[model samples]
Target: MSAGLLATSPGGDVLVAAIVVPVIGILLLWLVRPRAVEWVALAALLANLGVAVAVLRTVSSSAAPVAYLIGGWQPPLGLALRADGIAAVFMAMAATVLVPVAIYARGAFGAPGERRPMVFWTMLLAITAALNLIFCGQDLFNLYVALELLTFAAVPLVSLDGSRETLKAALRYLVFALAGSVLYLLGVAIIYGAYGTLDLIGLASIRGPDGALLLAIGVMTAGLAAKTALFPLHLWLPPAHAGAPPAASAVLSALVVKGSFFIALRLWFDLLPPERAVAGSTLLGVFGAAAVIIGSAMALRQARLKLLVAYSTVAQLGYLFLVFPLGLGSGAAPFESTAWTAGALQLMAHAFAKAAMFMAAGLVYEAIGHDRIAEFRGLGRIAPLTVLTMTLASISLMGLPPSGGFSAKWLMLTAAFGEGAWWWVLVIAAGGLLAAGYVFRILVPAFTPPEEPIARVKPVVVRREAAALALAVIAILIGFLPLAPWPLLAIGRIAAGAP
Candidate 1:
């Protein structure tokens, strides 16, 4: 069978379902009673998860990219939805994280009546649809639309509670995201004028090291970096993520920013030539290293639990950019496979672990009435399960043994050594140590006894704690996989000669 039809030519149908099912849920939410919104959202997400799993299985088993020609026309003339290995992995990750976020949102947002549960559900579904669209988009223009959808969906999530502080944060996020959109659109225009095509594969076939291409790449990368909240451009992240509700924070930190970073990865590694990638890779890595240092330090200084986790996300994103340097360098030993897999694994691991941690922290805040980290003493007595979940999730974040974070770090370290990029190895190690410090900052106080009788603590829900623990366990379990390159990641990559 041809590659396009490998999934019984059902790939396109599944892709559309993945994107449309959530959108349909969003529309249905407005028509349905508010009390039923959560159930509908959950059902839609579960269905999306099944579709995502099916797509992953089909792509991995086929070991090729799955393409769905829209309106029965081929690329450059018509739009297409395509899922390669990376896209499949991200789709699955987003689906996995959304399930827990949806469950958590039930209590946090409240069901129906007065609090506008329908609006929350609608935004959640919209966010899911946008993320899936970004993952599957094969054309640059289509991706731009997906990104706009994501930003709009995500902005409301920040201020779901309608608080003044959260509204301010949402506004800041909107302004910065708009700036990024303008820059990205300008870059897309340049690319279209230069190459007469916006399809990634089509452009890759004819791209050259010219002023137009380089200028476009620089503008696009900067724009994506802004959207991703990478390092120096992270002015809006800490406040926006920290101010949102726990479920919203988890999705924002864990998956939303990653949608843009994934595109940046594609722009450099898949679209640009090896020679062009070298200098650009180093520049990106330098920014990544700085983010690791600066973000980790900022995380350590945060007084609030949610704010600390939010800043940690800023640091973790830096690790993703390191892939540019480690994977694209020509002088590097042939460790591209390991670097690619490691970067991807880091993305997945961080998503699961961070989401769990944020949810767990939210539970803690609900129990304690506030999220001040220093005042978390005696929390273990009140909510052992939630605290335990936080600890487990932190283990992964700190890159300790038997957690996905450790596996990702080990592979990245190996790739760095193979390439003689000792500086990156040191940066990775430093980031881990800083992560340990910040994680322990919370763990120690939560586990320790209070100086006096604990004040009235809110009741902890068993189901909520279980939901958070499940995600943390999944993150830790991924570490047990063999410590080597992951073949699943390489499936469906564009062939060297393919357009």
Candidate 2:
């Protein structure tokens, strides 16, 4: 055992609270009145958000990982939950996004004693607990369990309305996710058989280009790609996200897919040697480039607002995988490179922007009674705040200046220039143009003048509008980050060899 890896840090108990508080809220839901479900869920999530921020602060100040070993046992014999810099960032991002989502959902799921509200709140809490595990898990088997919990929690939200189309979509999502799980588990088994240890730090110390290790990584990456809905394994995402309730769509799109993607990052950068994975990293980049092009084209063709947003998610996710090739190919510690910072910024930016966009879509549907893009003429007049939310989010999604998307792409472009990787440069530029095309498709019709005045079917609450807009503004605020490699991201990264 690496002695450095076994010691728990001060304030490490916050990690335990991050997972436990939400679980407690899940249990409290049944005991509270139906109307109190929203209160219980919100209180727990708020507390969880504070915990996430505390973890980030501790890691930032200490410049090291914060860890808590379960039962004081070491890895391979017992489990450890560790929060490295990247994990702290992911946790903080997830918590920040979840709070706004919970607030926005109150308008829809806050009614007293309703079955749907109960189910939604319960699943929301379940997802919170599962995501905490995913960020803190230190071994493959534990990560697999967290992934399964996230999948199960998210699937019910997809079919919450119980419509025939949604049920079918939910089933498809579940099946594909389970298939991914099987492959992941198989990889974990192979790793244990070959290395006799599953702890990430332990694996990193011994990782090599051994055939068994290579095979395990291949299968595991394939599985995580399916779970993350990376094209061409992305068929399940559009239907599932588009058909769900808007609040659910926000969570599914912004955070759930990221859980799997985070594990993929750990696998490729932590458990595999970067210098040796050149070919594999490039292959992953190729798929990401394909996802950017094809996913954007599909989004441009979607007739409904929600479906357009869903496909946009598929396109946005492609940028993340590009970091693998850009960082690993740079001939530097992947975690210390600008590409790595760009990828983290991209993830945070997309979470806030996409969540806001989905909430706006739901509000649009509520006002106009339909989400058909063509029928959105005069949307600005009927629901100006919702339209404003969409516009602000689009600014980020289109990679415009003074927004998170812009900073991420700018850093990525700089990294590509440094490496003289012109092919990737072209892909990044083209992806931005295509993103602009789809964003305009939504904005143009919404701003168009109606032959006659359009009336709202239902009134939109100011609280919900503020909630969505707050998320969008945060996406923009992230642009203020210096367009360079972040030192915080480097903390504890070398210990596990994670980029």
Candidate 3:
């Protein structure tokens, strides 16, 4: 199937279930106590995972987008929910990561009768629903609604503890997200005025562009970049992502920002001309380079393990932007390029590896009463499994051999050399080194033989450690992806401007 090859395919109903299950769980959570809510949400998540897998299989089997136009009405007048190969892949990835996070959170938040656990479950399910909506949404306006829901669900998670610092971080995140919304909304209005359609597929059908079109795209990109916390606009990220509970931090760092970044990907890759995309891709790559440099350096300076992991997120996210210049060059099809596959790998690798690292950091905090890196001596002895999880995750993050990050960077470097974008190769190499520095900052102290057995804030829980380890293992498993680009990502990519 080529681009624009959507149909009202079989298994289209799964998309609705993927979204609706979480929403129903969130609603039911409000009326139930913690234990029932936990069981209900956990069961719903498992069903959602099954639905995600089904959607992916159906899309892969047919090699076409599965579209469910609301009421069977066409675009430009009616909304549509469409799942292409990319959406299906991301949906499966989200569900895969979320299941373990749910398990780990069950241990952290305690039994379901507590106020915080109830609220956390609600937000978690809500985010699951919002992310599904964003991925499936075929209309720009419909996606904006999904974005708003995601922001609302994510912001409160940062301040779950109600500490002054965390509250401030949440507030700061909210303000920036709101500004992004306003800018995005204005761009939507402009696009509708100029093109008379807010549907992605419909907009792609238009040929020539005017100033209004360019302006709308430009403003929309800026808005999304702010929401994504790319480079200079990333002031709110470290604090908010670091301040949240470990499970919440995992969601924010691993998946929440990806929501906006995915929209930006759709705008540039799916909607824009290849020629137009080149310039924007370069601009984004430049910012990405800066984020790698600055964010990595900041990560190395953090004395706290959680904050260090948070800044690593800033650095790691930059890797996604590098696909533009590297993929678009070398006279290759954009979707077929090594850089494109490498970027997708980078995203998945970061999600799993980073989630494992953050969860491990939380385990460290729980056992030791704090995450101060210098004081982590003997952690390796006290909580060997969690330490092992941290080591595996750090290896992935550092792009070490036999890890997903290693494979991704290797592919990207080959593409960079093939395209003569060797500058990015250097940037990627340096980012790895910085990642190593921070990883060392944690591991060195943690492995040091203690003067005496360290006092524990609490006994280490095996279930939580196993959950964290599972995520780390998944990150390593991604290293097995073939060195060549998989055909999966290219399933529905059509020529630019082809209606």
Please report the candidate that would top lDDT against the real structure: 2
State the local distance difference test value for candidate 2: 0.91
TM-scores of all predicted structures: 0.96, 0.98, 0.97
TM-score winner among the candidates?
2
**Candidate 3 residue lDDT tens string, 1-499:** 3333345667788888888999988888877765688877788788889989998998999987777867767777888788877788889999999999988988577655877888898899999999999989989999899999999999989999999999999999999998997788888999899888888877777735567877887888888888889999999999999999999999899999999888888877777777666787889999999999999999999988899999999999889889877877656778878887898889889999999999999999999999999899999998999999999999999999888998888898899888887799899999999999989999988899999989888998899899999999999999987888978887665343364
Q: Give the least accurate 10-residue stretch of model 3, judged by summed lDDT.
A: 1-10
The predictions' CA RMSDs to the true structure, in order, are 2.1, 1.5, 1.6
Summarize candidate 1's per-residue lDDT along 296-375 as a digit string, tens digits: 99999999999999999999999999998988863532223688888988999999999999999889988989999989
Deviation of model 1 at 190, angstroms: 0.5
* Candidate 2 lDDT tens digits, 1-499: 3532577779889999999999999999999877778999999999999999999999999998899988888887888899989999999999999999999999595457988999898999999999999999998899999999999999999999999999999999999999998999999999999999988887888767788988999999999999999889999999999999999999999999999999999888777876678999999999999999999999999999999999999999999989889988999888889999999999999999999999999999999899999888899998888899999899999899999999999999999999999998999999999999999999998999998988789999989999999999999999998888998887777434432
Q: By summed lDDT, which 10 consecutive residues of candidate 1 come out lowest? A: 1-10
Ranking by lDDT: 2, 3, 1
Better of 1 and 3 by TM-score: 3
Off by over 4 Å in 2: 1-5, 494-499
